[model samples]
Target: MAHNALPRPSSLPGIEDLRRGYTPSTHEARQSIEERSKQLRLEQERIDAELDRHIAEMQRLSLRRRDVVRELDLNHALLAPVHRLFPELLSEVFIHAVQDPFNVQKTDFAVRVLCGVCTTWRAAARATPLLWTFIDLSYITSLEDPLLRLQLQLSGQLPLTVTAKVQDQAMQLLLVAFFDGMSDEDASRVVEITVEDDGVVLSQLRSRHLATLRVADVNIWDTCTQGELGFLTSAPTLHKLTIGVQYECEDDDAALAFPVPVIPDLPCLTHLILAIENEFPVSAFLPAISQLAPVLRVLKMSSFEVSAWEETKPTVTCEMHVLHSLELQHYTHRFLTFITAPALHAVTLIGDDAQLGKEDPTESLLDLLTRSRPPLRSFALHDPMQGSASALSGCIDLMEGLQRLNIEDNERGVTSSPRLAAVLQRLVCDENTPPMLPELRSLSVQCRGDKSPCVHSDVAAPLSQVRLSRKDPRVCAGRAVAALE
Candidate 1:
């Protein structure tokens, strides 16, 4: 199409006279001004029309560009490798993407996100029963809420790991109803139960198929009767049991005087963890340990204290023939003197300076190792107050078959530099004297406290000597030094 030229107002005959301020005194001059003005208005209108056409064309091209981009993106997504994966493989990917399915705070978040992605993903997520097996009752607001029932239905007949945080009487009643409403098959499918409740809920709930049970904040005085804890004895398949007791009484002595609930003999039990908030009398649980020693493979005791009266009493040693791993936290040397593990391979002792009392922990440990003489492979000591350089050296000298050693010194004013330096120096091989822990494959030493400039210098030489002499490709060294502010 041919276009008309736009009028140049400056080229108009009378326009220059108007710019020079020439007054139109005559009728012809005034008429000429009016004619010029009329022409200029017509040119402005044409320019505005041309701009509107350009804007419309730009809008149309922008819409076309948007459409093309959308098509390109869609085609790229269709050609992606993940889209070609089968539904089963896609579901597996979704499963791995979900982190900590049993966590109450993030319960069902991953599954809900997967279901919202697309129709195909929603179908795959719904078809995978393992994705819905974690039943966290803490998120359920009411018994009438269909979320719980939906999870149960979606999980199908798979083994469910249930976590319940029943804090009030209403939640307790709800928990009771939840168990009572379950079918026999559903009840049998619950293999693991972690409940943060008082003893009442656990007393009533029983499952023969239960393999693991963790009860937190259990009030020993509430469930004093044997009948209340009879459910524990009924689960023949139970292998792991963790009990955490927290006493809120003002008189800790009085609380300690109360009788501890006698744990029924668990024939199949292999792992037992007891965490007490206050310093509990060891006498209360000593007999129970003696009873469970034969079948127990892993035993962990925390915050245990031997009463002054009990300290005067004779130490009754309990022999554990099959126990392999033992961890003690905030414990005294007297407690270690009472047990002997012949098959122990791993020993982890975590305590502060106050827990060491007057007794040397190294001596007690040496006694245990000498008495039992098990093939100890791994040993970890965390901030023992009495762990002097000489004392630690004496203990490490006995572990000839040790493979892994971890020492963490977090004592406030005490640094593990001296102890670690001495231990590493002993490990260095000499022509005359053989190296201690010749089979050691892993060494981790962490020292946290006010340290001197020479702390690292003191430990570095010995550490380098041991590392180079050991020359084993599998030897791994982890050294951490932190200054306390």
Candidate 2:
């Protein structure tokens, strides 16, 4: 063959020429390619459809977010007009909102929100009585004139039991407002009036409506307490009165300054607790108290007043039908003569030191318990053994119905306490915690002795005396019995 010559191509085919010249090899191969092309085209159409669906879902979520924002705007929008139209509604809103005490704890947001609505809201807030129902002068420094009007309205028909505690300011205005609400008619409804203020502001005025009065922790450190008690006599219905007085600038000869409010003849007093700070001339009061508190069930005293007279003969002329529980702490001899609670159920004596006093009072106290109205169930006397177990042992049968009993002396140990325990051993559980008490289900004993087992071993049949500590000889005996069986 001669040397072959080839023609040189001028350029590559254009996109249009390539498209036109494209061909399939066979019918089957052409069908396979056409099917693949149709699949690719359909796949691209499906991708576009999915994109459109995702865009619709995104639009829906955005519209929902806008709706929530709009609702929030509407809800917050209603409050402003409500406060303006009905100004009293501001205080009412506070009354309803303050139902949750936590709302008023740190910041009274609900209160301020209502008050800040407008000037009319503020005026209505000042006038509304319910808003000032509980006067927490704990935070108030300045007084608005309407405070008195609000207090009177809030008191309504009920007599006042005003319990106020103020330290910083002269709470005289607050007291005036409170007392103004009480008419002579409101005296019967008053249950108690307790005021704890500094600087002896109580000396400024007197009240007549109170039935029960307790004034404690007044910061007149040098103020005499005895005369101050007289100030409480103004209350006509007052039966239970407590005064905590301080004696300052003590001139032994100087007479004490106090209010002399005439204490009414209290015929209905059932309980009285008197705490005199310094040496008070209560000898004058002894006859009066006895005559007045005729039906008195409980009488409590402190160490200072009644220490003088060893035997204060308290006449039990009135019927003590409802006297059951008696508690005496730091009592002196004069207080003891009045200890005739004929109907006493339980007696707890704390801080009675005969060692310091002139007389040994163990016998008199025991006599009081034995002569009580009913059988005593639980008797607790501090350092009881310091007196005599024999005296206390006499009080066991005071109450046949008394099932629960607790006797504990932190000072006494195994040797000293066992005497009392022996007397109370009737309550002990020998077999399955003495089932004698069908009414008494549970019993506990905390007093322990060193030589004695921290807990006594359970009684097993006659053979096994000690089953708890394995070292007990009863274990060997039990094993022997088993072998024989």
lDDT of each: 0.68, 0.47
| Per-residue lDDT of model 1, residues 1-485, tens digit only | 23677555658675687799978799997898798889999999999999999999999999999999999998998888878899999978877766454544445664567787678888888898887777777777766778877778889888877777777787777766776676667766777766655555666755344443432223332333333345556566677877765533345644555445567767888888887654555555677678888899988878644333343222667888999998876644445667888888998887655555444556668778767788899999875445567767877877878888887765556534666777778877654565577677788766665663223557778877776666643322432111111
Estimate, for each residue in 360-452, the C-alpha lDDT of model 2 and write its tens digit: 334556555455445555455543345454655555433344445444333323344554454445433243232222222223333334544
Q: Pick the candidate with the highest lDDT.
A: 1
Off by over 4 Å in 1: 1-84, 99-106, 141-144, 206-229, 249-257, 304-315, 332-334, 353-360, 384-386, 412-416, 449-455, 472-485
Worst 10 residues of 2 by lDDT: 476-485
All candidates' TM-scores?
0.70, 0.49
Off by over 4 Å in 2: 1-132, 136-151, 154-159, 166-169, 172-191, 197-204, 210-263, 276-288, 300-322, 332-334, 352-364, 370-385, 397-402, 411-420, 426-485
Clashing pairs in 1: none
